[model samples]
Target chain A: MIRKGMIILVLVTLMAPCVFAQRVHIDIQAQSFKKFKIAMPAYTGQSDLAASLWSSCAKALRVSGVFDVLDPRGYITTAALAEIAPGTLKDWSLIGADYVVTGAASSSAGNVSMTFQVIDLSTSRKILNAQYTTQQGSAYRAVHAFVDALLESSLGIEPLFKTKIVAIREEEGRKQLYVCWPDGTGGQTIRGGGNLVLNPAWSPDGKKIAFVSYWRNNPDLYLLDVASNKVRLISGLQGINSAPSFDQTGNHIACTLSIDGRPELYLIDLATSGRVRLTDSWATDTSPSLCPGGNDLVFCSSRAGSPQIYHMEFSSKKVRRLTFEGGYNTEPACSPKGGLIAFTHLASDRQFHIALIRTDGSSMRVLPGSGRGDESPTFSPDGRLVAFASFDGDLYVSDLMGVAPVKITEGGGFQEPSWSNVMK
Target chain B: MKIGYRGFVVVLVVSVMFLVTGCAKKAVAPPEVEVTPPVVETPKVTTEMDMAEMVDPEVEARRILDQEMAEFENRDISFEFDKFNLTPEARKILAEKASFLNANPGVNILIEGHCDERGTREYNLALGDRRANSAKDYLVFLGIRPDRISTISYGKERPLDPASNEEAWAKNRRANFVILNK
Candidate 1:
């Protein structure tokens, strides 16, 4: 008999790569790692809609990078899938499946119901069971919800299925804002009334976006309310009113403005027209990203004669430099999941790469997937992946270790990608 | 030897006669050119003497004014990479621009700050603002009204040259002038 303290280091989720009882940790950044094999057959009572729902679930599992969804053709056919008997589970074990996900869909009066279960092949037991009913044509919603339930319950990190990413697409000499799912699907173009739209930053609730546009022939900051589809001018100062980011409360925005002379960081109160000057120097300060807490923020500055990332604490007004190794670094993005800052680092190849450092200014490491002009690194809300734009202007999302970056956007002219927080 | 020297003298006399006649024909052609541009047998190459010497004083003044206006707009002030301080060449251009603006008070100008595509987009925007405003401030200090000049920073968006080499980058980092109001 054994008892344990609740230090909660990690949970041994049932997902494993092979037939043996393999312990799976949730960190995809681990150097020595193998994907757990998950078998997802077509949903029973399948229609076109059911097939799509099952496909979305499978795609989410694959995008998570934690599972190797086995080919459906390799699944056993003409066999009894009724019970978790040793004989039946032996067939799955032999097929290299660690777990089998079975689901069913039924349509009623304008509603679709889905029931799914995750069965452990190695232990011969059912691990998760869930039932959901959504509007008939809205079964896609259930797909993400089910995947979220599956992962959040077992792995403690919800897979990125429902999250969205926003980027700037230059079309015919005009730059417009666009939004799509994190998988680079569902591209919806947004014309925010400008010849050039850029620096899109999503609010914490995911309902509001703060961006800068050249609509009035000047770089002015504006807020786009996703629900109303309306834009409100937040700052239209004399010089530049750009690089806006929201505090945690979503009530104020921190941005760079050159109203006086040089570029300096300023915070604007949304409710009131009141303003607070955060930084005052001859040096240029821009691209302020607030920490997960509203108290501290990091930004880019040229105080050292070249652009470098700096950390600023609001309470003490104490500022420290975050990057020292690189002569050029800018566009610091504070991780929403906490304690990490991602920015663009110019490497020896003279190409820009995404580098991550702890908020304490330690353990700075450059990521892989370095392209010629990789910039604007935004952390996924789950904090596991970062989506950045490359020299070709396509957005790519890679994990923290920067392995196997999936090209999320295509055909260039798409860049300055800002990953939205997971939709409510 | 006598025959060769005599032949040389004859050739020189014939060439001098042709040159004199040609000079007389060209000298007589200016009035006709004032009426309509004369079609010379050779390709037209206009030197400063062509405009200043042949044209009347009023027309010459208009031409000079036009040249100054074009120079005001065409002569862009460039900056060092990642720095916004005005170079001596930039200051010289701004001084000349001030002289032009003062002479033509009815004209207003817009200064557009641009940068090379080397740094992050947002930082470049800030750098561009500094470049544009620095040019504007210098012009203002040179006795130009602040309201007469408006500045905008295109950041790395509008490049005078889009190539990604040293030459293109040097051309791109500039503060360009546009005559906004005439």
Candidate 2:
């Protein structure tokens, strides 16, 4: 009996080291601006449908700027079923892949079902495994869902793939509003056939968009229900009624109304259609951006001789100037976390550049790689990226790190790009 | 007595020549007086005949308003870079505009505030509002009624010149006047 007990204890001691060896901890925060290497094998199913899903998933991941997607030719594991099963980490690790994604898709009677898994190549552990069913035409959505899940699992960060970007696109001397995916795909014009439409602001719920249109021969504010394509007039004040921004609750809006004989900030209650004047300055005050909590707002005011960003507290009714470095800074957009304010700064070179400043006015940094005439900088929902419009009218996305500025839109006259919150 | 009779005959011949010349002068004077009456009455007759064709005040006001609109459209008040405060030159132009408004009290004007493409759209719009209001306030101070003037800020949307240079920007940062009613 004593000899048998000694043998069993020795066996358990030997297995404990192997269990510890199989656990992989990928500290994504430590990677910072470095892209993680990932290998994605082709999904198995209806050949054409699987190929389409594979391409979309790969594109979404690549455009996210967090992954260095390896070419399929470098992937030695060609079988999707084999790659996703257990004990296949050695093959992917051999090719220097930190993470591996494999999926199988099937289509029947116009419905498509896909099963996908994200594996940690170092420890041979499956980090994510899920199945999604959708109409065959909506395969792209399913792939986006999977990519978002993989992102969350691998990086421990919220996914931005499900969010949309609203911007104004001009064509043939006409300006229109459009909504597109983050990757600049699936662009559809929501409204057009007007003299000019600009400054699209998305509601916090992502169901409505408020924009300025000259349809009535006046620059009036209009709200569009994105689902029904219905338009409603929000404010048609006697004078300039423009630059509408929704608060966090989505129940109140802050905009610039000239009804008081000067461009001033006014908060409009969506339920009662009542307005409360927030600013009464003789100088111009416009472009009110509400912080995440909706209790505070940052806007551009010309009270200090030139356009500069200012902060206003709701309860205290106190107004303070936030930006003073540049003689010209305007169109301030507060981040989702309410810690940073992004604005357009007119530099000494007489060119506009996108810049960031702390909400408390402690630090200021001009984001690198900003093009001339870059204005209307809006932060992504996660605050990881900032999308802005350039002078040539193309929309470009830049990381908060100020690197890898990718032009996401083509053609000209795309301005006022506003990122939407992640949709449920 | 013989010398006196010879002198009298000379006087009689001289008097006869004087009478003939006097009658000829009298004949020319009547014709001149006849011609002067028609020349003086011609303008009076036409003035009376065309009483209905005389300028109607409404039509005259409209004509003046049209002329003012055309003139002011070309006479936009310009400002320095990133400035909404009126310069001496801008104020002078506004004073002239105020006088025009005072003269044409029946006309209502819309002051369009504009800006160069040097700033953000929303800020430019606000700056434009300041510019238009600045002009309006000066007009009010100069005795133009506030109700007679309205203001709108076009920001950097409608530029006079789309070129991206100093000259074009200077032209773009201006306040334009448009006639809404007269």
Query: Model 1 - which docking category?
Result: medium
What is the Å distance of residue A98 in model 2 from its true position?
A: 2.3
Assess each model's interface with DockQ, reporting 2 decimals per model. 0.63, 0.46
Candidate 2's displacement at residue B37, Å, is: 52
* TM-score, chain B, each candidate: 0.67, 0.65
Interface RMSD of each: 0.6, 1.3
Q: Check candidate 1 and list the clashing pairs.
A: none
**Which digits, one per residue and each the tens of the lDDT, describe model 1 over residues B16-66?**
999999999988855543467777798768654654357678978888987
Error of 2 at A290 (Å): 1.4
- Candidate 2 wrongly placed segments (more than 4 Å): A1-33, A40-58, A70-96, A102-117, A126-139, A348-350, B1-68
- Evaluate residue A15 in candidate 2 and report its C-alpha lDDT on the 0 to 100 scale: 12
Residues A1-424, model 2: lDDT tens digits:
2222111111001111111123335543232657778888988877888888888777677657677678989878676552465656777888989888887888788777777777777667777777777666556666766777666666655767668899988877778887777777667776452768878999988888899987887788888877666788889888788889999889988999988778889999887889999998878889999998878999998888888899999999899998888798989999997788999988766778898988987688886645556899998888777889998788888776666577777877788999999876
How many Å off is the CA of A349 in candidate 1? 2.8
Tell how far residue A252 is off in model 1, in angstroms.
0.9
